[model samples]
Target: MTASESMATDRPDDLPLPPGPNSYPVVGNTLGFLRDPFAFYDSLDDYGDVVSYSVAGEEFCTLLHPDYVEQVLVTEESKFGKSDFVQDAGERFVGNGLFASEGEFWRRQRTLIQPAFYRERIESYTEPMVEFAADAANSWIDGETVRIDEVMKRLTLRILSKALFDLDIRNQQSAIRDAVNAINEKGDAGSVDAFLPDWVPTATNRQFRRATDQFDDVIGTLIEKRRGDPPGDDFLSILLHATDERGEGMSDKTLRDEMATFLFAGHETTALALTYCWYLLATNPGVRGKLNDELDSVLDGDTPTMADLRDLKYTDKVVTEALRLYPPAYVVFRQTKEDVNVGGYRIPAGTSLTFPQFLIHTDDRWYDDPDEFRPERWTPEFENSLPDYAYFPFGGGPRHCIGMRFANAEIRIVLATIARRIEFDRVAGGDLDLRMGTTLEPTDPIEMTVVKR
Candidate 1:
């Protein structure tokens, strides 16, 4: 149905939208929502805590209360399904892999894939993570203010590729990086604009198709390559040869989708998180100095080890707080599979849900001083006191990111590796902007003097 058609009707059950600003008919606030989602959300506070609005002509309700998130994410998995918008747009690349798959397929694949990201296996990737990061660091010339975000993207992409595949990758074979990156930049934005199909031969759609195809080819090759001679177990090798209890292997389409998801899930978000960490460090020197002290005390010229996660408390705090400020998956989109009560509102069946972690994390209600950049909020005792769903960088409930362990470990190693040698003093004068995408990224280039600390 056209957005105009969708918005024109007030469902018999429709309650006046949970109290937020009205948007234009059809288009709604979709363009504005896409422009600066955080601000678009924050501005909604003029009305109330929970707000309902439409975007891209689809009805959505935002849950600002963390308690509500706990209910949505943890207590009621059945009530919500990963939104169709995501399932549809994601299908273009990730296929019916766990991330895009719903119902039994999602359940089955998740169980099979869950073990690969366990503590033991993720720990094994630490050394490779440090090695790749250290090697990436060596090329860092003194007195240069490199774009740390770009550096981070390159770092995690390499880590996910080599560590997951053990240097033996699948269908994504060679073009993996570019293909995945292209999709990251273009695939899912405005996916629900029924008036505009992404497959149209428009230049933007052509670009998206080109990128998605490259990504698909790469994942396809990796699957086929590994299936031929499955040896030396890694995530891909295991998946390449994984079969259901009935002895049937996944369809080629399924494997390609999953491989793309892993590639996307494994790296891009981590890079953004690390990028935020650097920005936070650049802006707050006091926190930076303390972090350096932790690094120096923990390791005597050796790379950060997994065991360091316990002692490098401040480093852990930095990463955690950065996630609070700019979560990798900025928003968790869920749609009601069936209507149920939430935050005292009767969310009807088929209503799309917008649970913005960025908004929830920053809401003044839960945080003492939400605007300030303070890592101490993540102190051992303090962190434990918070509700399980209050701080959801990796999200919560069954769908919490599987790669959390690996990402945390890799980000820490990369953070410490870079922090130990380079001092990233903020560019000192520029208005920074956050470009909202599949992940949030700093639109401003941080030009800092990189001196050997």
Candidate 2:
């Protein structure tokens, strides 16, 4: 039966929603949501695993349990799709790219683009990721404080541009970064004005539009130029020639969306992961020592290769643990396509359901001390003992982030390359605010002093 037909109900009122806070009329829980959406969702654990809440007038249920998450994102995925709110907000910047698209369109795009991120192709990016990270490390002066976030962002952007598109966006980096920041702020759940209509033409909205247009102009030109040139090895070249089973390649507009998607997804989250990784390392000296030990033993003072990275087990654990605490994409939202009972709550069709990685990763049931940065916790025994959905930093199911493998490799390469060459410590007394934006970014500049080792 079809999704709607299966969900057809006789007494819709009989379905009971999970318990939650009493919301005010009209505004609902807008105030609480505006105060802090991530915290608001966290508070729902006090009510129940599946609890109802509202933002503006719309009803949303937050799912905290891993079992519930499994059902929503994996087992019964066909009965759910990307949240309308996410699409509405994400499209402002990413357009109908993989991050925003749904249904058959998303599937087709995934098919065409999946090859660009394959293990073999992603392995090729290791050299550039290492080179860029090394360049950033070399540029830093000993004993001089620098904003680590800015450093990572620049390194990641340079790597992404060269490795993915084979284009140098150094000149356009500031404008592109600003555009991404604007979209992130506007799209954030904590932004009270996030629900504002698109036609309103607010200042933030105008900036968002301008940024996207600027990105489009740049990407459009790249596409037009690449269309006539001989195919190269970068993702753009692969995309230029990529054809489906029907033997048709992506159109110019589709190519633009995918390029924008890569620009945002490729650079943004990895930058945050590297930033947080450095923060974790600086704060935990013992962990840093262990990471360095593994690097030294494995590399013997040389740069890491793709094959050598496998033996850098402790380094991988560091990346995994940091992602657990500060997942770049902290939450995944889905809209139910049909009536479904999950965790004993009957969720109606068209309801928004959230699976928050931040909450799941921190749950004490699966973790010994969830807040602690312990790379050793990621061993095979622990991984085997835990639930799959309990630690999904890269999301889960078929719709999980396609670049996860690529990202894993990139983060490891960058970390190993920089760590072997320099010693950096987080400056004392700088505010470490974990900003909730399109991706989880630092609210305050993460200042650190770098010294050549």
Candidate 3:
């Protein structure tokens, strides 16, 4: 039956809720989910596509099917908004920037910020990305062990700072890195601190406050410096010069919020993607050989340029496959603005909906040997055969990640440039124990030995 027909036949009030595991009083499934989120979410697949669950007394319906993902993110998008918890949590961290704001405010902010990500503008970032990657790769001594995650984070942050703000932030890298880590730790879904009230006088709360303050200080100083100087061809300059039809531009506060959002979201997500890509390559010799062959043929020891991106086909697929296996933004949360029917289940208004890329991307129904790392499977024919949402490493729809293009370019350029200069061999860690934080993070640092190519 059609979705609308199903809804017509069974009003939300009359229909029974979707089947799911039973919940305990008060805490609901909070403890179980926190124990091991991957296993918990995977177990729900047996209950059906639309499974009802609760956490801390809040109701949620997880949509496992790609069709339902489309319904929430695309076609019926207006009927859903960012979930309440997300809005609240995001606002506390990044303020009412694009990631948190909604309605006309969000629309206006997006319109103002969109120009910075235009094709020509993003292409301009290629030089910094390649330069930073090459520098990082050259600095590594052969046979020296390094934390791959930290290396990627530092490299991506340098690229981001130069490309986005036209500033040298190496001096402040530690402060910014600490701040980001503190915030993520407090925001981790599995952490008890995540559920506590912000006003509470706990160590997590204190650390969170300190982190936000430190971040604000760093961003505030840079924005102030930019305002005093002549405009440059960077994102900060774009935001500073961006005026509305009424001839007004973003206020200092607004700029800080947006800057925080981009800096935090842009750098962190791409870093994780590159880190995971490296881990996968280290573990899979065949994939690494193929990637190296493509890099050798296309780049041949030269820094990658925007033009070379067209020929970096295998490199692109390797990144795509890595994202599929370990999407940084593991789960997206949305709330129903009105009662909605999905997968023959009637969901009431105000119910939270989860679109888990981590779970859906690995579902064997859409991907053969879904647990395996096979970049070769990303042929055009294979991609065309799957549902659109089945492979959305970046979330889909109008509200999809604004930096999707920027991040894609950065990941490819950095991966190609670094692979041309060096190779990584896993030293100790075999598999990642991922933590579902603001972004998917490895519970421990991913250590690898760098070998010059």
Candidate 4:
């Protein structure tokens, strides 16, 4: 037999999966965790770094340790491939776009779209991002209680709708939010709905179906409008008019999928990141004060210009450290297509591997006082030695976030705009219970009293 088979059969009779805590005959940790995922993970050590858990007979190993994560995310990424959850979700909404595709199809899409994120193209969006942020911040009620989470959510929504698509989702906001709300509400309702491969008449299924349709409608209209009258400047017009060196262009359906991919994937992740950023800043007075000082000294209470973002050094570090503490997309999964050796464990191909970024970000093994939100950790000196795969707030390798440059500029500018204008008092009962979904979140909505600075 081959070496890969040797490891799979290496399971001794007494070793139940040989990696994680022992299961209770068949149930695993299913009933034990409808809540408190952090505690669930903390208790998994009884089984070790690689362990098996069967959720309704679909068993996948939960991975621990940073070394194995690197193998999955960096070295053997192409083979491992994104799991079905993303594909199923994408196909249901946007058809077979980049996020929904793999192999040559996904690769071609990536190459075609890469220029849209070129430094010059991204730099152009900075003005719009700052403008939207300024309008949102102006409506904040000074010294009055504000749902900071809602404000940031709107800010990201506007940025995604207007700036990214150059069209407003505000018109379709109700349809979109309702669908996302249901998706979240039915939390962990099993991966069964995804496996159906077709929609059903169930209320939850209906909601998702309607939301995706509405999203497609919005994207479809935008694509058509841009195709007719190209703006020659914005993203939509660029995508509509883009031609290959050979004069080839994307199909109409392909254009729709790409736009949907950006719309669906980009907005929520950014909202979660901003929410956590505000919470961290509210709790840590010293960090908040220091950041405010940086904003005041550099931005001087003006809306951060595209040029100002270049000079806003500390703000980048702050957002970087915040992402480390609370990465928007907490876990990345890849299913091994062929047998692979990883972090000293040899396993047969088809093994599902998880790289829990949340664990790595908080673990002391990689960082000094990992829990502490020290923006200085990303200093020029320290940043040099930091591992490439270790601090990926936007992920890394070929599938890294496309709009990372845009996101960094957007977040820093918005944070500075809000920071220099107002201060937050943390809610006495502010509870940040992380919900493990598309993005982790504070279980309690963030309510804070904002005072004009």
Every candidate's lDDT: 0.74, 0.83, 0.87, 0.70
State how far residue 352 of model 2 sits from its true place (Å). Answer: 0.9
Best by TM-score: 3
**1-453 per-residue lDDT for model 2 (tens digits):** 322233344444466777899899888888988887667776888987778878876779888878778877887789898988878777767778888888888888899888888888888888888777777777788899999888888888888888767966666686667766777768776675578766578888888778788877877888898998888879989999999888999899888888888888888899999999999999999998888788888999888889988898889889999999999998898998887777656888888888889888999988998999899888899999997789888888989989998889999999999998787888886656775777887778889988777
Clashes of 4: 4
**TM per prediction:** 0.90, 0.95, 0.97, 0.89
Model 3 regions lying over 4 Å from their true place: 1-11
Best-to-worst TM-score order: 3, 2, 1, 4
RMSD of each: 5.4, 3.5, 1.6, 4.0
Model 2's TM-score against the true structure: 0.95
Best-performing candidate as measured by lDDT: 3
Ranking of predictions according to lDDT? 3, 2, 1, 4
- Quote the positional error of residue 213 for candidate 4 in Å: 1.9
**Candidate 3, position 25, lDDT:** 85
Candidate 2 lDDT (Cα, whole model)?
0.83
114: Cα error in model 3, Å: 0.4
